[model samples]
Target: MTNGIRVSVVAPVYNAGPFLHAFVNSFLIQTLPGDSIELIAVNDGSTDDSAAILDDFAREHQNVHVIHQENSGWPGKPRNVGLAAARGDYVFFADPDDEFGGPEALERLADFADEHASDVVVPKMVPRGDRLYAQWRYETTQIDADLVTCFTTLTPQKLFRREFLLDQDIRFPEEKVRLEDGQFLSLAYLKASRVSILNGYDFYVIIHHPQQDHLSAKPVDPANYIGSVAVMAENVEKYCTDPDTGDRIINEIYFRKVLANFTNSRVATHSLERRQAWQRQQKWFIDRFITTSRFEKMDEIAQVRTDLARDGDLDAIVAYARAGSVDFTFVSARSKRGNIELAGKLSGGFSDGELPKLVVIDRNDKSRIVTIPIQLAKSQVTVQIPKETLPLMEGARRYDLWLSPGRGHQNRRIEGPDRPFSLHFTDDRDVELYSTKKGNLSIAVSRGMSTQARTKRKLKRIIGR
Candidate 1:
């Protein structure tokens, strides 16, 4: 009863006329054997030439299959339909605007799944342009990865064992709903026995279309979005039996999706009525899932905002949305004895007695954080780090600096000057301070000869200094 198809790519196409050619071409050029792969393009009542383009591909290629359906408003119904029609061992849900990372993307994923007997396979997903995803989880190939740690990645753009999905009766919520991907993936993760993460190469390239807006890019109603999240929370409670694991999953969702909505600048633009409705919905979720102990473990800013929203303090919440954000400006750096002294200015809407803390986070290992108290005199701040404090024995280290405005206020990264600057410590350790692409201040520490010292040594050998 089984065909030879190893992978079936189910793509729900809407008004994707502009991107249809490149999208379909990405699949056609796959290095996976022609007979082992199929592309199922479900046209969801596209108004443009998308239907014609899909039909053309189907006629030209035997592996390309096209299904036409009425507009589903969202991708859920079309995705479900495409899933039902898939005839491969594994199913991959794809968006028409994005494409495979390279020619061998599907071939490698299918081979890895077969070797590991994986119920779910997640390949490295890299954004084409400036978009970012959490890269820490995909740092290495993992077999049977912990679902709790991998909960942040809930998108349906992963390889699912078609039999496992069918056995669990897992299907997308067939409605025009937000976070349907989260709901579907949450159930899959809970039911999956063996989940494998492949990090060797990029398998999926997420591209942003210049002329079109993705579904996630469209404006979201706060109430409706939170309602969808609540359904995901319900899934966690129902399927996840362990209370501790359930709390961790729910807490992560609350932090990433629920609390982030209020802390971001978008909430500032909401009308009074809209903000109130958002607060009401958020409070409902928090009361049900987010316990006090778990809430306290969140960032100070998140704790403050959630508290304000839960208490229905509209004025205070608005003030936070408008002005309580933080920022830092780096002025200079100097070598003091064997230590490094940093000077910066902190700016934010803090109350009269509030103070900001200098937070140093290790880029390699986030658990290693150093918090230093700063005395702000006329907005100027200074901090000195001893040579012993630098993780010099760890070969090379990069630490990002942030200004954490105590309690009730959000933190911000310190912005450095236009050009990178360096300072040499007396401990034979060289330090280069630079601004990251995102304009955040970071210092790289390395042992042995300093760059300046190396340049001097080279000059001495040439000129006999």
Candidate 2:
């Protein structure tokens, strides 16, 4: 019988001094049996006062121990160090910036662990704010699977049997510079049994630090993500049941991990060469997955565009549109002439040629212009953005969506319309549209365009003064 399971919560600290206190305190707030729950705080060579922070906590509480290590090149090495130090039979990994769903959730999860004798127990997530939706990786509904569901999407949401991890020789790839959380899960899931899932507990408070995207600032290289994705793809190909299943499994991993390079690029502070290198590296990595045929999927395009944009590739947008990454639709009523406009009698297109690549998004399909290029000799030109490219924005912080145009650094700045307005391009060609809310609401225009001023004013009106 599984001796009363020892629940060890693994908190990996690296320059986590800012949020270290509450993260540690969240555990202290839990209701688990005092002896049953353990906190293994790994201070992975934090240059900040993070080690001191953990040290302070460890001093206050015996469960919160710290493992000081050298400055490793990757996040996984420190986690591996922590894994060795984890004394509990079940290990719970937590990021210092995030928090548990609730104080009692861990206790409940531990109880569930005792009841099912599960190798992996997954918890759910709920959105913590306006711009962000909770990400639980696994499905919210009750799911029980040995390979697909258990071993696949639900990797991050579980409490793993430490022995199973050690027995299988499962270790976080120390070489991986990023996304190993997924890699770690994929590795362990294959050997797991009785993967139980628990709802009602959002075990982690994944913070969306808007100011910190690689686009807006420095980030670990996207190439590191490539290495991580490569590891996952190899693992998936080796362990999955069949070619189809393996493809799908690895496809999802490829989608998320590789897409990370792009997403991180989006957060970069400027269009620097370093960011471009990441994008280039990402493009190279994506080259592998693109041939998988699934790249043709709209979600695939969406993922690619996101990665590209994150990598700060404005040109990636052309690829995004060409790949049919934009899936938004328009409800346009056109004039006898080629001119196109919106439904509200506002901004209309002069010609089909005037309708540059545009994608219009709104609460409904009744949008005016979504920024998809369709040659309108004044005819309405519109298209849809794939669901992936325009993810729902609920709790993003400090988004720097600058949309100025022409080309390169010379594009003029253009904010989105003042309000959600309809279109009336030239004549009877009037329609309505909305832009996606997932990123910055700015757009740019070229000085070559004569109507740029009118376009900017109309947008200001549409976006609301």
Candidate 3:
């Protein structure tokens, strides 16, 4: 047994032989001393060589612990086993397919946890070939500000204080279910006293290979997906006493899950049979958990989808899913005097007679959707250059521009090499641009960007060119 371990990294392995070596080797090569960190790997009945590979590591490494169990068809049971065996000040749960972004990831997490005495520390979850998680915008955030805001991300791939987890009796659902990560995370966030974030470095590299047979890669199983949501909703009602918080969580957060995860996918890609069945299941869920008041509180698009789903209108749902399509063209980016101006063209179709508008959103501000006027056209829509749209570019992050059909409708973000764009502000106090060695886009800031925007005069005064 290992002693004085700073962190216990619990990874659940299931037929992940191809990536197991790389995944386990990441912990062995950590900048955090091998003796100071323990890797508790539970092999959940893999028919592949994953068991043999883990056994070899257990023999070779002093801090490696391996447990083999009959396949449970999910990572939940295996992770729970690993959690029981973990012996560290803090615990980290990881998937067998994903690896640490860097050698020092554990060291960094340990340092941050120790310094802040935090219950949870979320490092940047850098997905394969994509931007980092937008939710992680600051170095640290206290959950007291908005208990649901900081920890809404349901992924269990985070550093948790061992004592805090035990004290709260927080564990993943044993039933092999979809979106289980979010269910456990929501509960953890609501109960957590303190939550901090550590960015500026990649802590986790999530690999998405087509050949991978993970749950997400498989076909949509409506029963399991809705089951997962039901479990999470039950916990929310049980734990949360604040009526207002409960209402907001159910409407704002969980309602989005019902659409984005359950309804949207079923409508967009699944077969007609599957779509109808999924709708039937979701309708039951909606009637019970999702109140009429909550449905009314949803955004415009969400309300439309929910109504269509309730009515079982498959054709209308499909049309609504494909209603708005935008092709945005980035013209140029220039800071004028104290204003950061970005010019782009909006070309696409809008439904509900909704006009095209330039929308700028910050990574931190989830509620603020700023709309800028655009010039509409027959074949393709156009928007004037960075004129009075300066306010759109003001954010903690270099704002991501979206050509939205209407104020509350869905937005299509313009990405890729063609008609590219970037933002640079003279004032490095709140947000600035910097190039990373890995070539990922991130705005450099001395401090966290203000969640609330400054008045027009205050913004101009601070952003002198």
Error of 1 at 296 (Å): 7.0
Which one wins by TM-score: 1 or 2? 1
- Model 3, 1-465: lDDT tens digits are 236889999999988999988898887889987788999999899999999999999999989999999998878888889999999998999988889999989888888777777788877777774324554444454433355555356778889998888999988888867887878887787687777767778898877756778686677577778777777777778877786677667765555566663334345667888878777877877887878666666677667667767898877666565545545665544556645444455544444265667675654665655677665555444544342333434333444456665533566665533323444344434434333344322233333334344455577888985
- Would you give me the overall lDDT of model 3? 0.70
lDDT of 2 at 122: 70
Pick the lDDT winner.
Answer: 1
TM-score, every prediction: 0.86, 0.62, 0.73
Q: Which stretches of candidate 1 lie over 4 Å from their true place?
A: 291-305, 319-324, 335-348, 361-369, 373-398, 408-412, 424-431, 436-439, 445-465
| Model 3 worst lDDT window (10 residues) | 440-449
Each model's lDDT: 0.82, 0.56, 0.70
Model 3 misplacement above 4 A: 1-3, 130-132, 135-145, 261-268, 292-297, 326-401, 415-465
Cα lDDT of model 1 by residue, 207-267, tens digit = 7666786778877777778887888888888988777777778878887788655553666
User: Model 1, residue 97: displacement in angstroms?
Assistant: 1.0
Shift in Å, residue 171, candidate 2? 0.8
Displacement of residue 130 (Cα, Å) in model 2 is 8.6
Flag the better candidate by lDDT, 2 or 3. Answer: 3
